[model samples]
Target: MDRMMMSDLLKTIFSVLLVLVVIIVSRNFIKILKMAVDGLISTEAILSILGLKIVLASAAFIVPAVFVSVLMVLGRMYRDQEMSALSSAGAGVGRLYIAVFKTIIPVVFAAAWMALYVSPWAASKVERIIFEEKQNIGVRAIAEGKFSEYNKGNLIFYVEKITTDNVMHDVFVQDKRENKVGIVTAEKAEVRTINNDLYIVFINGERVQGNAGEVDFVLETFAEYAMRLDSSTEIQENPITGIDTTKLLQTQDLKELSELHHRLSVPFSIIVLAIMAVPLAQVSPRSGVYGNLAAAFLIYFSFANFEKVSGSWMVNGEIPVWLGFWGVYFLAVLFIVILLVRLYGLAWVILQLKGKLV
Candidate 1:
């Protein structure tokens, strides 16, 4: 019976994980494609970045998939009266838990590795690839007869034509800096690197600078002028997701601590949710295998959202970092106990425990 249960659980977990991965990957693919279209990322880097994104997405969904899979497999057994047969053959709830946990143990270990190491590695790779692509974007990404935006839309460049040698003609540049707007028009322009700094060298250009709608505008015409576009010294700070697990252990920053705790919570949640699923999966034979899924989903989403809100609270200093992440798991354990008692009755549960003790 345990072997059969383990087999069903494994199959269900893989099926659910695959379906979830496909759904998430499709949505993220659209966003990645848009990033390529907007020139935020290179077309050549799309597939590489997308593959890393899949790793991250799969890691994020694995715990939830396992939880849901547990519910479905156990619920099906109950609906099919297999659970009744087991109970008749001296298989108690404790026996069922042993079988469920035998499957969960390996999953928890695999999930721990993914959440701690693999996902962070993939996130860092994606960030590094994007930063490297953006460094050369000013020169390589520009196209004739199209407006391109850079520096997060603060700078716009438009060129009427481009020669085979990569010189631009009839170039228009608009830079919005705080309250001031600067406009430059050039007869011809070409990219030049001076001292490792990227600059657009414009010849026979006119410049106008002033606050918008203000009359005190400065206007000048130049024989040659250069505008800095990017510099080799520019550095992109690593986001929380990209930080290595070992490095996160050395930090005392609330945001970093929150992130660290979140990674740790992934594996912890797999265990807790699996335990909760044992009781939560209980349903009447007539209700069908999926009958309790609505309630299970509600609990699952609430559990996930609670973790998110707690992490935010920790990051914002609203809650102590030590308590914010693990408190929800404690509440989940309490909920599981309450659920077990509700299903089996307090006296029966106590009697079962006492019997085991004796």
Candidate 2:
């Protein structure tokens, strides 16, 4: 009988999680698609990339939601007197706890995989794809007859004609440096790459470089002049996703410590949350099955926020890293124990006020 109940509860939780994941993923994907369109990303490319991101994000978001939903479902069942019927037939609260424990072990293992392995791998791959696309696509976007500004007005380039080979005819280049304004005109120019640097090779051109309140200089260029184009700087700093869990464990850096704390906490949180949920799901005869859902949501969200706040404080050095990281979990565990004692009618004795107070 206990095994059957546990199976039913697991099925309910799985169904709820699936529905929630679909909803969240679809909503976020739509938002990302809009942003990609606004940024002029190709539709097919954006969809492909956004799909992967949505799956990763959905996995992270759904874990806690699954726990909450399961609690709500069980709470509703109790409120509707199904649990009461089982209790009358000799099923005890112990059975519920056992069921929850069975479910949580696998859930926590999956959560550990997501936080430690899957999420970072997905994030790193997505970041690399985005970087490559920006570099390659941006270079191809320079069109002829359009006044193109490169590097935030440091240089303005215009061409009257562009060919299939990216050669430009009647090219004009304007360089703005300090109070000086320099302009160069070339009869023909070609985009060239040398030593990983992008340059515009000009043929038959005259150069003028000067500024107001300064002596002006003018020179005629002969066969060729190479003007260097500034390219986007590739990021070299190690992103958080690039750091593995094992590597993080060996470091004492506050930021890395905080991230490691979060990774470890995610799985532990699943267990804590499961323990808290069982007692919270208890319902009186008069109340409906869904009566405690709002409260459960409130509690879950508060716990999540507390963890976030503690992690942030740890990273910022506003609190001792070890204390801030573990302190929140300890507090949560204490709260759960108190709630469980209350549910078991042992709170009065535990408070040591049974004889002293009414």
Best by lDDT: 1
Give candidate 2's error at residue 256 in angstroms: 1.3
As a whole number from 0 to 100, the lDDT of residue 316 in candidate 1 is 87
Score candidate 2 by TM-score against the native.
0.70
> In candidate 2, what are the lDDT values of residues 1-358, reduced to their tens digit?
5566567667776777677778777787787677566654544467666766765765566557656756776776776788878889887766777766776677778878988877767776666666655544444555689877777778788889998666889889898876678888998888678896787788988888887677766666668988777777876344686477889989988888877887787787777787778878777868864677788888888888888898888888888887877887788778877877777767643554545565
How many clashes show up per model?
Answer: 0, 1
Model 2: lDDT equals: 0.74
The segments of candidate 1 whose C-alpha lies over 4 angstroms from its true place after superposition are 142-234, 352-358
Highest TM-score against the true fold, candidate: 1
Q: Write one digit per residue (lDDT tens) for candidate 1, span 16-128.
A: 99899989999999999998888777778999988998899889999989999999999998998899999999998889889999998999999999999999999999888
lDDT measured at residue 108 in model 2 versus the true structure, 0 to 100: 77
Error of 1 at 259 (Å): 0.5
